[model samples]
Target: MSAARPAGPVGGVTGCVFPPATEARLAPARRIADAVLFEGYVLYPYRASAAKNRLRWQFGVLVPPGYGRDSGEHSHQRTECLLEPRGPGGHLAVELRFLRARRRTVQRAAAPGPDAYLTVPELELSDRVLTPWDEGVPESVRLLLPLERLTRPEGVEHPFLLPARRETEPVTEKGAPVGRLRYATEEVSGVLRLRARELPGPYGALRLTAVVANTGGWTAPPAGADRADALPHSLLSAHLLLALDRGRFLSATDPPRWAAPAVAECAGEHTWPVLADPEGGDDVLLSSPIILEDHPRIAPESPAALYDATEIDEILALRTACLTDREMREARGTDARAGAVVDFAASLPPEVLERLHGAVRSLREVSPVPGAADASGEQPWWDPGADRGVDPARDTVAVGGVAVGAGSRVLLRPGRRRTDAQDLFLDGRTALVEAVLHDVDGSVHLAVTVEDDPGADLWRAQGRFRYFQPDEVTPLEAS
Candidate 1:
């Protein structure tokens, strides 16, 4: 993979291959990428019998076209990113990564014969419990494309395949063979199409579009076939890592004002590209099926991948710590990764747990107020109630020539700028204003509840209500 080489389509390349010197170059990005790759590989409680664990592969699943077409799952993902190449001999290295699901079936000998075995959902051995599980085998396809070749009208198309595999592992009970695990996976085929075109902007930026599709042959499943049936032939957690030889890639989420228009034109389907270099370089871009912000990272305090990325590490650790001995055993027996998570959670010291409790990502310097701090001398800015200038309950905003405040009545008329589609249904509905709120930006909002809704009282009791801007409501006459 050389930048000086002429542009041409490279095919039949399979494996986790990184450009020269890029393995270390992409280390930081790979850490976050690994988290994304196995975002939901397994859930907390980690036991195969857990309800949440039953339905797996929630993210970045590119199922067979035949199954996806009818099931609403996707068969492909597309990503578009902007880049500025400093030289004509520049090149792009793309690594397409995904998981291949392997179905493991537990089997027990029926009559002590070598070939005679009875399939079972689970087999309890002397040492552990064996349950039928679907495991993900990491797979990747690497490609190096010349930027000059991508500029061609026809672009470049590369096809790749992951061959089928089958294996068996014997399970023993005190050195005696009791059962075995049969693992099988179907062949998965996919193609990547990359095209680059010059943008109309003065920045001389180039837009690169990469589309990855699952072209594996699949027979339409039976009427009752579920995701588990189609999963073995699917690409789980499909994502791409793109590295530039000698250019910088612009942020698609937060581009500079001058490049805003060009960034707006960038589009994607089931895929989003974000700047990946943790040091703030723009040479590496991570295109993921999971939408992520620029330079997304795993928290340093996070001890391990809990599969529930949305959960706080402290909370997960605490929850895992409280699991029953039987539950822990079940989790440990479910999969090797699950066993590792269990061990990791149990080994955290008090100080490590405290660190995982929380960390303030950033803070702003607040000017000292004469009487802001108490005897403790801690900053009062941490407490919102410390600020006495604002009161939501007493705030008032003029609407339709009326001073609308708490306990006022208004008719909702959601404006075209409405943020939620449900707001349209509230249009022309009578609502009781609970409070007039002012945001930090000095914008006024009227929090109200539908007067006729049966849950109006409950909503007020819970302090939950819909909010509308000053112009989105009209003051009604007092009854």
Candidate 2:
């Protein structure tokens, strides 16, 4: 559900794929799942005119059958996960969640007559600002099934349809209607299919596959039509939630040695499955369109969901708090959720803002060095700069039978593993080495500035240099 799409192909078949669980059982995971649900629903400086906002719905988009090929988006997505059931008797509650697109257009009228209406991009009623934009409505389809039912050779299939509709809300001045907003949506149809097969491992593991597809009956857009024209017929940010009565799901990402083989055999298209329970139990698995680690949880220090999960709360909050009145008004008019973010940022107390500044999620004991302590006593373990033994300027690394350190010269030969695209242009260029550094993991790196670069002196003065592994460069001379 982010603006940046993950690299992969998408596929689908649908129904309940997990066992039945009570509301209380789902409450914890539901909170984290909601964050995933609206990960990029809106962004900072939220406005309909923003370029980023115009290209929305980048994750788990399921366009109608024939339209996918034309639009370069998939109509379905599949989730393949490994489960180690404790016994043969087990049940699963499957919940499919996604968003349906709603197209809202502002309209104006000179008088209260049907023929007097004229389409407009925006309109103001009193202090309220209205603008034309796309909005998402949440939808969920769920089912529960016995483990035996899913074991059948044919598996199980369930088809569903969300009917289409059109709505009109009046814009009023005093008691009379002045203008109206028209909301239109298209019918969405999809099917869910679930199947389970036993693995060859000693751990009685089973590979479970769940597929969700878009079967909506909509014609493909014409040759020149863009994705915006097909949004109404698509399922936005689709993902699955599964709860089990008995059985533990092995992590597909970090499975035990024995189950690794089976995990490799499991095929997943577009979506990935990870353990969902924040408490570390494996009974729940979230098959999301966006990749996530096992037992993912939101930080408690966060005050609100800003729709950009990858960004830091402190930076986003500060940026939102600094928005001018005009920008705030446009953001408030963009969507109700955007308006809430603006209000939350403006109302944050000093203490609450400080909390968002930072938090320590973990701490570890460090073994003291004989001479690590001084007059001020032992340095704080969190301060890496306190280590007096390390000096980048005096450090040396062996490259091509030469000691390369500060003031050394080298030929830039960046390796095949292209970490940055700009590295391609730097290959074969000469550079002046600024430092030989060792990371916390004990890997050596050379920091250098391009010899021919106009800003080389400025970069060297600011202590900023491009970094490369020892194997990526050949030493030419040592200063």
Candidate 3:
């Protein structure tokens, strides 16, 4: 392939297309605009065929917002790729490499000239010669990048580690930022959304985010040294996101397949949905160390969870309906005065509780037409474990008494493990879970594991049934 005529880093080396042998070094690499960059660089004898001590270098990149194709097929990408000389360069006695970084006065390595080199004593993958630009892609929707580098010699610090975690809280004066975690909260529509952020080790990595729902009664528990008083509750929804650059690279490292999109790349929002872990390389980024602290007096800390407007069907029969958003807000007020006088959700009278649970269950078990073939039978990928909103209960959450697919899903708070008969039988074993489910379908399934959101545990909630969507489940046998 021809090398694209983009300005070279620092100095121009008249990049050229390397022969197959030399190109093989950059083998297993992805396509660039016109050429393929070696994942990193390598050095050896210049003798057309012999291996001598030569210089080699490579760089990992984290594509920021507004990167590749912004529309059409290649939207939402920060493709992980490489760039290198099409030809040779510099003195072989002492080798040097360069990488483009966010704006900064280039820092120097132990060597010279603004830290010309970098070193990593450890990396995620070893022995398997991590060739330049040879890294694979991941099938995730929101991809966050923090690239890490390695050094050939000890103490030779690479300059890239400086520009990380502007958004993260530092661990301590003496602590490395590797294992530390952070918790944050954002409120919308009077609901407090909790988030836990973590950055950890050894490589320039991808961002991993999970969103869950607070199905249980209490809030998520804070993370810190064991808190004897912490309440554990399972969460509801979870959604994961990963980002990408141009759509020209392979994703995943194991049995690797091309994750590159077929059209020109674009940058914007997109969703990857589902992904395989082993196939996708461990992130190309690493977060420095950090310390985690949980403070619940400020806000109840609980398991990470996510909830969307689509699934509110558990039939919460309030003593009176709010009717309007304003009324809802007033009734749900968090004011200290209101809180002091209002009855706690747990303290509601037995009649009210019975009424509420009964209404919800009634909605859950309502059949479409007096038991017509239970359209939700054993079909392809119908696990009785997913949250199938009030569809099966058409008489309640439907329009004009017509049956819908899965209008909303309701999960009881506080996780509950299942007995053999309770959960979806996986190899004859009860499915392990911490979620409560209530959907259009009469059956209530349990929330097993979610995709994102580190918060949300269901251990705190008392006895309550969950929703089960027969159509949305992916049974182990099918997978």
Q: Pick the candidate with the highest TM-score.
A: 2
**How much is the lDDT of residue 156 in candidate 3?**
18
- Which lDDT values do the candidates have, in the order given? 0.81, 0.80, 0.22
Q: What is the per-residue lDDT of model 2 for residues 33-105, given as tens digits with 9 covering 90 to 100?
A: 7777788878777777788788898888999887887667999999998887778778778888888888889
TM-score of 2: 0.75
- Go through the candidates in order and give the C-alpha RMSD of each one to the true structure: 9.4, 7.5, 27.1
**Between prediction 2 and prediction 3, which has the larger lDDT?**
2
lDDT of candidate 2? 0.80
RMSD of 2: 7.5
TM-score for each candidate, following the candidate numbering: 0.75, 0.75, 0.16
In angstroms, how far off is 468's CA in candidate 3? 27
lDDT of 1 by residue, 1-479 (tens): 00011111122338556666777767788877878877877788889999999988888999989888888999999998889998778878889888888788999877777988899877875435678888777777888778999999999999887788788988888788887889887899999999999988578889999999999888564666887788989989999999988898999978988888888888899988999887788899999888888887667777567766466678887899888877877877687777777777888899888887677868655546643765576645445566676677887888877899899889888987656889997889999989877766768888898998999999999999999998998888742
In Å, residue 254's CA in model 1 sits off its true spot by 1.3
**Residue 177 error, candidate 3, Å:** 43
